[model samples]
Target: MSTAAVTDKRHSTLRAASLPRWTPWVIAAGSLVLGIGISMAAGLDSQVQWGLIAAVLFVLGTFGVAARVEGRRQAKDRVATSLVWVAFLLAVVPLVSLIWVTVVRGVKVLDVYFLTHSMGVVADTEPGGGIYHAIIGSLEQVGLATLIGAPIGVLTAIYLVEYGRGRLAKAVTFFVDVMTGIPSIVAGLFILSLMLIFEMQPFGFAGSLALAILMMPVVVRSTEEMLKLVPNELREASLALGVPKWRTILKVVLPTSVGGITTGIMLAVARIAGETAPVLLLVFGNPFINNNPFEGAQASLPLYIYQQFANSAGSGAAFDRAWAASLTLIAFVMILNLVARGIARWKAPKTGR
Candidate 1:
């Protein structure tokens, strides 16, 4: 308030700002030098030693400089923030590397022909064989799995959410949790055994059934979560209006939860698309294109990858094809996720006064 007091406050603030910003830089550099010295003194391997030395030195130097200029508290905060960024970079590097590798390797082998032919006639000597048959089989088997799994999963979820209570709901939940952790091989074995018992023979249909079992628990859990998130107020309002419980569920609840349900289904599909054990055991890959899943053996991308990599003659081509198939699978999942997001956005409740 007084002139002298105001002047004193301004001077104090100016004095506080006078410390050199380069203090932290100097400290970091000194720490780095010390780290290098320690690494050298210990006679550590060049790569590991140098890397550790650099990292330690950088961290120490950062703290030293920050503490000198910004005080201990601010310096710790700065170091923590920098460390977090470094951690994030570390996590992201692998994902970026994987995508880069997949795209680079996959594009080299991808072509129109690759999408249309099976490996049946293509010799390892030739370079132009396609994955057409494999693609079709993947679609058919996965499609059938969707058909089989979606209904049972949706119904189970509906029951759990709408009618299940106490012991029954808890049992379903526990079993679903258990099923979620079941080995993929076990599902294949179960289906294979069942087929053998029924004298149904191993085929693409059997693979579908196995995949369906694997997918159902995932779908049920996801759908149940989504359904539970639906506002109870909406259901109550519908019932208050004299809507039958089933009609209210059909007209309001289902519509409200449809977006999440679609997303869940897509997730389930994506989860099982690359499954190898079931298809390998049940469908058994064929060299020729087999559009009829019920009738005979069908080749899936996973089995195709396996066959190619297993044979010495086709190893290189198969490896290339495997990477390409991986890329395709990733793309498929990405597209499904995008579509899920779109559907969720479109179906989101309209908000207005």
Candidate 2:
């Protein structure tokens, strides 16, 4: 062959020899089997643990092998990128499955009676007892909690992000952080102790107080972050127009971050809404509906679930009620989130830019 013809033949060979883009991903997937073998040898108890270990090992082994075989850095990059997507899917599947299970199992017992009737007369296995009293108690307690906690949390957040400085702010921030990490049981105990000190007996309002304590720090931290995200220019603009500082904050800063603040408050509400320990400690569930939170025992959702689940009565009806109450609690949180979204959208200030 002539020199030009020989060069053309060499180029053709190089082009034909190039590996496909998908080769690294295929290699990574193959490595998953090898990883599973390794995990099996390790003798871990959980299948999920085995699968996760296998996937991770597969990616690493694939990366090294692909890099060596291809003799290039880019080969390893492609393998790593594909492995991330695989990992993401693996994580999402479990969460979706959990939600599906909760919904499917809980919806079976859902009815108007479930929403309106208390479990007072119904035995654990009794077919007909509804969760009306618990539902009402949950609403009342959480509503009161929201009323009490939101203002305290929002104001604390404002201080922390806006005017807070020096030693006092730091102390407040530290205490808030500590409060956030306090065990739910501890909060219940703290309230219990306080009530005892005051010679007060257990009541629904006391339970609401405990929930407020648990919720406040969460609200403060979330709202503080949201407030900080509000642009300084908005505040400066208001000040430039000769508006007073308090009014500027009230009108400009708060409106700008109202959506986020509302969202934080809703999230705080959700966090405390399901707490069983505090309610169990502070307010014993009653057989009948107690409208007066200050005076007597009240049925709340979590407490109801516990009571139903703990007691064995006529049939499996208690379990069904527990599931139904769970579903109701989940629905309430979902509704609160939706309402927060609506308020955020409606009240969010118009961005001039």
**Candidate 2 Cα deviation (angstroms), residue 138:** 0.8
Question: Residue-wise lDDT of candidate 2 within 1-353, one digit each (tens)?
Answer: 11222235333332221346677667666767776777788887777777777677666766676555544454556566767877797989798877787688788889886776766666666677788888788888988998999999999999888899999999999999999998888989998999889988778998998899999999999888888888889899999999998898799888889888988898789878889999999998987888888888898988988887787452387777777777888888788888877877776655555
Off by over 4 Å in 1: 1-61, 67-79, 198-200, 312-315, 349-353
- At residue 210, candidate 1 shows an lDDT of 90
Worst 10 residues of 2 by lDDT: 9-18
* Local accuracy of candidate 1 as per-residue lDDT tens digits, 126-177: 6667778888988999999999999999999999998898998999989998
Compute the lDDT of residue 67 as modeled in candidate 2. 59
Models, CA RMSD each: 6.0, 6.4
